[model samples]
Target chain A: MVGAGHAGLAMSRCLAVRGIDHVVLERGEVANSWRTERWDSLRLLTPNWQSRLPGFGYEGDDPDGFRDMTQTVAFLQRYAEVISAPVETRTTVTSIRRDDEDYLVTTDRGEWRARSVVLASGACNLANVPKVADALPDGIASVHSFDYRNPDQLPAGGVLVVGASATGTQLGYEIHKSGRPVTLAVGEHIRVPRTYRGRDLMWWMDNAGVHDERWDEMDDINRARRVPSFQLTGTDDGSTLDLNAVTDIGVALVGRFAGLVDGKAQFSGSLLNQCALSDLKMNRLLNSFDEWAAEVGADADVEPSHRLDSTRVPEKPPLTLKLAEAGIGTVLWCTGYRPDLSWLEVDVLDRKGRICHEGGVTSSPGLYLMGMQFLRRRKSALIDGAADDADDLSEHLAAYLDG
Target chain B: MSEATVNNGVNADALVAAREALTEAPQAAQFNWRASCEWKNGTHSHSTVEGFFGLGEEQKRSKTFAFDADHPEIFASEDLGATPVEYVLVGLASCLTAGVAAIAQYRDIQLKSVKATIEGDMDIQGILGIDDEVRNGFDGIKVTYEIDADAGRDDIEALVAQSQKRSAVYDIVTNPTAVTVEVK
Candidate 1:
């Protein structure tokens, strides 16, 4: 097994419970990405209750509580201790290949053979800071979502968070709270409920079969890409939590990051155009709930005090207050990152820099991928759901190990 | 330096020769399809990229079609995982060859097959950064074309030198392109 995050730990624990002996290989310290890349204030969207491995669930004062980056890093470290999972840290896997009966895994430290391998390393490997952005006037401070930890790290200036996806929106909210002037460069987004009003939306999605394999295989790449925005609360127990309310307070909303020209940062587009997209998605979700409620003979009249209207929003640049006069100082590239598979020399990856895979299996057999974001469910990327993902990949590993 | 040869620029014959050759053209071929477009979203969304080009379009746009989307543990999302830019890049690569093939049929130039590969680099940092000053779109795009034709290199170049498959995406990628954005 390669990697030691929630996916790797869950797989190892499942094996221990199943009485399967397997080896797990990690390139950095356990949960290294979570330990390193995550911003200091970062908190899991899923509560602590959901942060479980197969044989064990979190046992702490706050079952529903959410754990911040430190807590998560500590939790995974403790998990490794508890299960006595055979893990080697600071050992980067340099090459991977397959023989008839066994798979060969290589790292800077050593080469080892396993009957099967689990690529439990999550997708954080690729931190795609744009090449061109690096060439910008070095006077301005900039950072990717990965390197950003707290407000202290940013330059003392107004910030622009580009891309209105979760990262953009969430980070924009965080920085704004720091009392820094902030603007959110907006784009298309699908805003599902944190919960249907109050109840955990994942519960409905799970019970309604949102986690099924088929949901991952939906024909509408458009729809599948629209990962549901789940409840960021902890379970009934309140130890775990997400501070959505904290984020809403300080965010400055704007339109697409059209360009930066002259002394001013330029952003102009239809917020209504985008909100229309989000509004349609919201309606689709509500409609789905309504249809389900009707089928179950349940009422569907519940609605938020605030209703969304595509037309109500302004079309001009969405800056809370226009900064058209002054030169925009810094750009917080919350735009997102791309995978760096350069070290993994494999032809399986297409020209687009991706490996071809079906479910968890890569085009090359014996080489399996796990904990991929949106790999199987939208939840694959979420720590709360990575346990199930580990098990899903473990089954395949067992086949490889057993056979 | 040599008197005439070193001092002289290209002869008028060379310029005229190039233009005449471009105009010679292959036989004409026509393709007809009643297609209409509905722009419901930005860059490339809501719309499904189908038909053919490059390697080929997947019947479904599962996260699996693009390497970056599936390996989220590794790659971050650009358009919130909508893979539109991926669709656009693949479309240009595939359509250009298809453009050549249709022209081949129209011109009665026997063409065996056509395939192409394309890649584009974008400055996502500009989009994410405060200095909206950085270029947000692709910095440069390169396409390598491989064709098996009844005619040789000269024929394929003649066909591709003037093909309609060079659509908006291709034009923007090849030429100077900018989006005007101000306070208004």
Candidate 2:
């Protein structure tokens, strides 16, 4: 195991149960992603009940409630203990190269010759900050969402939070609540309510078997792999951060960030269409929930829809705000992230630089990828699906070892 | 009623008049508000709360406001306006939000918007008489405010702190109050 996150821990447990000897190496402490990448007020997007590993589930009082950063970190640490994952903390891998039929893994601690290597780092190592961030003047401080902790870290001025994903919308909401004006640059995103039909949406999705979707079943697997994150929040009372709510809180909604033109942040005019698309997806999901509820004879009294007034925002919103005049002292880029594999000098990467793998098996003989987005199933990347992915990959590894 | 433009989402002149009356004569603020209600059935009741003033003989009158309360469909009552506990949440939210508005006006800050989400956890076991240990009142209440104004975060925090300090309902919940019951 290359990294000791949830994925790595799950793989370690599965391998251990199968009577395999493996060492889970981590650059930092166990579950370093949850510890270092999460914000101060961050919470698990899924409900507590869905926080299940192979042999353990959430044993807390509030199963329906979401776990905040502290609780989630503690839970991961407990999981590492219960599973007894032999993780060598602070052992950073410097490189991975193919040597004959085996793999040579060189690390800061020492080099290890292994029959197989599992890259369980998962995504979110390198933040995908756009080049436009570099063009901003020295007066404006630019920080990625991963690096952002709170509003106090930012200078006292307006904020232009780009990328209206879960992180972007959340940061926009948090900064706005702190009495700073915010402008959210809208992007393609799936919008789902936090709760629907008197049950958490995670429960509905789980019951609906959305997680069981396989790679082959997808009409366009590549497109599905790049689907935008959901526009939902697990913070403060846990509500949806739809465009309407964001606008209601005085967050200036704009289109995709085109780039800086003459020191002015330029935006495209696609906000209304983006909002419409999100509403469409939300309506479909709500309808699915309603159908499931009716099938289960579940009685839920949700209010009828009162459509958001899009007229509150302009129809063509390709506007620009002068960086200095707009009092925008900071521009926190809540854009998405990509995995960093610069250390792995291998031929398995595709044109998009992603690891070339089917399910969890890579093209290389002794190399396997686990915990990848859409590796085999729809929920493969989530904690709830980590066990299944690990088990499947372990089956492949056992066969390879036997051969 | 005539159409009138409202400024800062508040009637500034009316607020000034009320503030001036309270500041000039503290006794003018000693008006007893009353709520009379009759139960129609289980968990269903009608109430009419009268807002009265004691500023002068002409102001010694009442403005009637009526509403209904009933349990939700999940409970055993007809779905009416809202449950009593929901009403309590509504009161706390509005009182605090109104307090924000008033304080913003006092501070001469241009109010953009104010939003609040008030949540409380209650044990139905107490109301259902299943557990004697649990209290009928809420176990605890949490209020989250998302206020946007022409002020910094510290100012807003101070504003919320001051508002809660001076809020009547907030005081009622946070402090002990004397209540006597008698058949009249």
Candidate 3:
């Protein structure tokens, strides 16, 4: 397996349980991404209680709380020890190609031959910035969410955050709170309250089986996989962090970042419609939870269901902004991430560079993928979700080897 | 289940098959639409559309379609026909409305009626060379849909949202596109 992150480690536990001999290769330390890529204030979106893997779960006192990056790294490190995973840290795989009946993994440290290989390196290895980024003027400093650590690392001026997913909203909120004027470029995003009806929103999703929705059951699996992360934040009080939340705190809200034209940052005029869409979808999700609660007779136990206020949209959102003139020294692209599979020498990638896979099984025989959005289930990328996917993929890998 | 399979005047199965086929043969999906325009008078032009290239071959419509574009009288020009911007609004509305119908049919939601109203706000300062800061195009565009369908309010809203998500002209207007103009 490639990578020693949660996905790789979880799969290792599953393989060990199944009596399969395998080694996990890590480019850095275990949970390397959590140790480096995450922002300073970043925390796991899922609550602590849900942090679980195969035969391993979070035993901390703050079950209802979210784990910060440090806590998350420590948790995963403990998991690696508890599972006694055969993890080779600081070993980076340079290439993986088919070598006759077996596969050859050429790493910087050395090389190894295996009957099968699992790619759990991760989905967010590289930031997927748009081509329009090249049009920005020379004055502004551009930073992707992966390299962004804190507001202090940015120049002292206004910040224009592009995108409204979980990363964008959180960074926008945090940067705005740090005494910097922020303008958030909104787009189509999933909105969910942090807490609903006296319980965490994730609790509702878990109980309602929203996260367990399998890929095959979806009407459009491609769309489901491309769906953006929910506009949410992990806070001590579990308070919501949506567009309205940031707007309430004096952060200017704009439309989607359309392009940079004539040195001016052009924004889309679909702000109201995008907000309306997100509001509608959020209410629809809440309504489903309410119906589920009523059907299961669980409504009497929890607080009464209520709807969140609609996303507040400005009557006249700014269509363009002159970055330098507006004192906007930084343009943070919190758009999204893509898997970095440049080293894979196999011809299994699709036109979009994504591995063609059904669940975790790739089109190339005996090659598997893990930790991708909606890989097998809706929660396939969540911290608590790795075990279930690992369990299923490990079985498939074993079968492929036997066959 | 049987009633759900009822066709709502749309060949959704054929569309799905075409989409799958085009996914495997993306070259066939490379379509080039064409329109020719002739200057009639001051700010008035005649445009014709009849043929387009798609499915890896040149294709023609059953009949030629023509349109007249002119500035309104407020711009000190002839009010011979609708303005060019108005045609853009028409394109966006028609494309989105068609998407709504197609998606509704595919989802098995019988539609009773669908109406769309589109408006674009343009600042003429840029076109008049009065202000370089102002853009030559619409400052913003708004589209509203009123529909009576078999589905609920949320489902209808989803139809409009999905329509916008897939509309070609909506993307063209919302995002920047490259255009080249030259004289032979």
Taking the candidates in order, what DockQ does each have?
0.02, 0.01, 0.65
lDDT tens digits, residues A27-144, model 2? Answer: 9998888888888988888888896787888998898888887888889899999988999999999999999888999999999989999999877889999987889998899999
TM-score (chain A only) for the predictions, listed in order: 0.84, 0.94, 0.99
Candidate 1: residue A60 lDDT (0-100) = 87
Worst 10 residues of 1 chain A by lDDT: A238-247
For model 2, how does the per-residue alpha-carbon lDDT over B103-152 read when each residue is reduced to its tens digit? Answer: 77766666688899999988989988999978788766788888887777
Candidates' RMSD to native: 19.3, 26.4, 1.9
- Residue A197, candidate 3: alpha-carbon lDDT: 94
Query: lDDT (CA) for every model shown?
Result: 0.60, 0.80, 0.91
User: What's the lDDT for residue B166 in model 1?
Assistant: 33
DockQ of 2: 0.01
Across residues A86-177, which tens digit of lDDT does each residue of candidate 3 receive?
99999999999999978899999999999999999999999988898888899899999999999999999999999999999999998999
Ranking by lDDT: 3, 2, 1
Clashes of 2: 0
Query: Lowest summed lDDT over 10 consecutive residues: which window, candidate 3 chain A?
Result: A268-277
Model 1, total clashes? 24
| lDDT by residue for model 3 (B66-132), tens | 9999998998998999999899999999999999989998878888899999998888898989999
1 against 3, candidate with superior DockQ:
3
